[model samples]
Target: MKILSIVGFGGQGKTTLAKAVYGHLKPRFECQAFVPVGQNPDIKKVFGDILIALDEQTYTRPKLLGLDENQLMGKLNEFVKEKRCLIVIDDIWDKKTWKLVRCALQESNCGSRLVITTRIYEVAAYADEAYKIQPLSHDNSEKLLYARIDDGEGKYFDSLSAETCERILKKCGGVPLAIKGAFLAEELPEEVGLLTQLVCLRAGHWDYSWIDELPEEVGLLTQLVCLRADDYAIRVPAGFIGKLTSLQELRISCRGKDAIIMQFVEELGLLKELRVLKITRICRSESIESALLESLGHLHNIQELQIGNYSLSKYRVSEAGSLSYCRHLRLLHLDRLVFSALPAWINSSLAPNLSYLDVQVVVVKDQDMETLAKLPELSCLILHLTGTKLVSVKLLAEGVGYFRKLRFLKILGSLIRFDVRGSECNSSRVPSNNTIMPGLESLEFGVHVRSLKDEKLQLGFDKMLGFQNLGTSSLQRVKAEVNCGGASTWDVEEAEAALEHAAAVHPKHPTLLTNRVESQYMISRYQEV
Candidate 1:
């Protein structure tokens, strides 16, 4: 029996140890059980709750056997079978509860490990081994502090202003919670106020929870309004992120001015552990130098990659060799791009793993459309494009229906033109009857249409007006828009009618459709309201 117990005081890392141990050992065990006994306990009730964590499917009826101490021992003995199992009783206080349960589970085999964490040393001694987990090392503590700091708008604190770092470290005393709360306080004067409050607190009396600190910073959420920035060069000092090898999600929003922040954009490649990386607006030209998609290949575990406004500029599809690197990506959000249709290199339909894709690009070609259309696992798509050059909607008419799990779709602009003999929308390019998007909830599109030389119908809008797919889609919201070619169509009569039509089709909901020229229609989506 490889039994280990972790013991520590009230705020020490007891729960973290159990979680880490389980994370380490679960794949090895045929069956694993994790039980958390809090500071106060009803031993009987905690044990009864054990069934929920165990991965047992056969037992449909979960019976809570309220056995006496002796009967409980028998029940535990009966509970564990030949399979190598794990039983963790956390925060145990008394010897009576331990002796009975310990004796009962003792019949299990050598590979079976038992882990328990409690503050009381006697309870810890009952186990075969123990570990004392202390607070953060100076470096580990500071890394967390610097990562979340919003250095004053103009100034970047790489080393956190020499004196400030020292003062914070001295007062916080290596206690992680205090360190976080202290640095997060408003001004130097407020820090002094917090310190005064701290000195008044009796030993072991301060509430360590961050939730307790919410009221002080709650107003910041509403007061914050961001002005556009080309890029931001925030200081990500070594101590803040040096040891973050397992780091997955990274969101560095640049609410700064119109300047290049290569330090922020380029350093991403170095963090081998990065998965979900989100950065605000960067000029399209910034990416030509960026080995972005390539650097992210190291993060094979990435789920989401988000970029803000004007990020995806005109790169040929061939330049998008980076998309190939993200093998496991599920969600891609391109917040606000200047144009439509993603660059050509991104035209790989082979990303079978993608699920949710949202882009604000305005330029997309037929091939890019076809490649994205074929993604089988793609469930939701929100593309707010400004321009599209596809000659025929058949590419969509053909491909979108094949997606079995597709639920939400929003496309903004498209061009219409196709030849009859496989030259325009090739004979083989048509979607089969079953290929229509069936599970759609929200669809918004605009296409350029040449009803004649004198008029251009936003073809995507026209298709949505007539196209109806039943049994295949359970659409809850549909916003179809058409470009009337110019400003003459932007009248009150047109807006109200379109809005009224939207209200009637989705009558239960508010207005869903709009008709306008390209500029107003595309820009409207980006407006927050």
Candidate 2:
């Protein structure tokens, strides 16, 4: 089979180019199918679409849904084996999906053709001839933008000034999709309300100065399975969320008082189906009432919870600190909370299903580490240790094992940054028989070079290399970010070289990313795919 692939970023016209090619080639082939395989695709639906495109007589109903992927592919292969088919798979996201789809498109030895369109480079590399979609030229982009807005002839275009047209074209960013969406004539009605039987609804904080609150009509959408609202200026209408009994996910980021906010948090107990919930920027002076805390415990179906920056200074931190009630919680993130130590309820009985835990704590107690090691299902841990002095503890110290299933570790904030020049800690701190996190596949750590004036900061490359000697030979990738005040080229190259040497002996050829940036945290660095 002959294959042609088009690859580029979103809005770069990969789909448009595929459509154009399909239009030109469909007439020449005996059978053709153009299928859109989005980010999350069902292979059965894709096979059905291919069958319909080829005008094949096949039963596509609820009964067919029970067929496994292999069964579906087998039926599809039989239909297109002999025909000179032209198949286009659009917007493929990953190789695993492509491999599954490719197995069904067997080589007929009858001059069939395949075309793939994707944003990922590795997927495009599978093609015999791959073309990278380039950004539109200045002249072509202007022509396209004018064509979308112009009234039939050039009369409307002649009325506009050169300066205004130039300003509009500049915002298009050399992308045809952006240029096409630039100008529109109609404006929405002032008094607007969404009315639907939708299973999901997302409302933005539209013009906080003008729109203070959501329309009362939002209460009508009781069938909502997921709701996302980011409104801070006004309180959500009382008893609003209590109606969405079917809601599986709820995400809200806004500001309100203790009574108003806790009242809503209390209402969450009514959502028996809730699996994921996130509440951010909730300001409350009084501690959460025991009754309200008990309300959160009723959400036994909850698997994911995120509580960020909830200032509860007056409340006893330990009263609501333990999450033993959330037996099914799989992912939890607690950010900027004042808790002296790890809560007592973090055992396997409290959150046995826990897979990911992200916490930003004031201090990292030794016993806290010991407690974390006991979680059987835990696979990823992200810790943001706050105190400057207490942050420099060695993670690879002997006998610190509890992370049997842990695959990824991300240490952020002050804990990652170290004042190497002034610290009394020496290289001896690196455990000679260090044996922690033996199963880790990825590690992202940062260093504070914020005060490295005159480049006096010795980029700790050798010390990093010493980490490779730790008991965990499974560590395959390491990402190190240096806050190099204003990173010079010299600093970046030196740090990268050190990481390369450290992983040189690794059997898996571990990857090392050294991000040298001026900010407090390292900015993300780009790598060739």
Candidate 3:
């Protein structure tokens, strides 16, 4: 993988440029991983955020890698061997953070790339490709600023006297972020003051590096960001993500990730809009977490809370505060964790909406499941179990039918059932043996043990049937899957033909099925084959 850095002074749009590159490059890596690196970590929350971003909702640190950075990198190395990935390092502050992450990044393929943004030019020099962020010209700067507020190039541009426009652009310094910062800071009343004035002050003063209090429209640009509806549900704007009242879903990994968070959160004021927060590693004393959560008492609507790179040591474990206030929460992915025991500060009622929860190193006491499953939204759950003790998946599945919503479950590195036993599975009334799920549109289950190629093929078919037999409301089975990759159409077609034949054999399964292997995609299927 090649390291590339986008470097320039603050407000130069390094992040914006990096994001554009990431948007263009992410598809190249099937197992792509992206994180904004930050300082510090707690033992318990290390892997949750990475897992979440990888779409591995059930990710938990393996027992072998508990708090050992090398061991962790070793696992990432294995993933690199299996598939290509892209790791984005955003707003990197120092060299040590680079060192710690660089080891894991080394696992990608030759063409895999690293894209980083930093204020320091030295950091850019370390990268294979460096891009410097530059400011807009005097004319383009005015064009860009005015482009933001008014609808278009009509009277808004014509009415703007050249002299006034120049002065406004000068105040904004022709930097994109600052222009965005000011334009986004637009609240009608506050904008009234700026537009009517002969000389407008930049909303965030570059001289003092401070954001001035503005009217509501301009104010929304601070903590309350304007985000699309879908984004608010899954990924919110960088500014809005920090301001959520209850961090039901948050994973902030970098050092300043938290401070950047508080700045926006104070601005947003927990106004019922936020839902998920993905945090990086946060390092306040053990007493801070509970206190921090307390401030979030007003957010009762959050459904999923993710703490990126959650460590065991940095926060207080109390039964009080925001953690307990989330009455609607269903999922929690706590990464980089290292707590010996689960704290009592959490309660089932707090996560009444919780369906999926991934945490680091918890011994899944019977008590934990008992409280966890009772949640109204409880359904799918994954526990990495970062320990040696074995626990039966069936035994775990047996209790949660009241959470009939609870169906999908995963226990990573657990000795309970290395292989799913028919007897054990059939024994559960919850359809554990059925190997199928009802009301599920898509089913993606993976088993990583070494299996013969033939066995792997057979198992794949068997698993598909298992899914259909469980009887979804309207049975949904593997259908029309386009496997895109490789260097030739013939190779892709050959593979697709084989898959289509397999689907054809399953007459009892869902009918509609087609397979098209695509070349010019990211990675070829045969790489692993």
**Best-performing candidate as measured by TM-score:** 2
lDDT of 3: 0.48
Any idea how many clashes model 1 has? Answer: 29
Residues forming the 10-long window of minimal summed lDDT in candidate 1: 196-205
Error of 3 at 42 (Å): 6.2
- Expressed as tens digits, the lDDT of each residue in 407-430 for candidate 3 is 555445432321222333212233
Give per-residue CA lDDT, model 1, range 347-462, as digits (tens): 33445577888765645655666676667777787766554434353353432434465777766655333222232221233332444455656656664432222245443332
TM-score of each: 0.47, 0.52, 0.40
Best-fitting candidate, measured by lDDT?
2
lDDT of 2 by residue, 1-529 (tens): 7788899988789999999999999999998889999875657788767767766555555646678778878877776677889999999998888887778886567788999999999989988899999988889988976675455666556555565566556755687765663221111112112223345545544333223444555566676777666444334656667777888998877545666567677787899999998876653543444444566677889999886654544233443543457788989886555454566677677878788998656567655665676688788899876532224333433354556677898876553322122321224444434435557799787654333323343546445333454224687788876665544445455656656766665445677777765643333243211
lDDT of 1 at 328: 70
Residue 272, candidate 3: C-alpha displacement in angstroms? 3.2
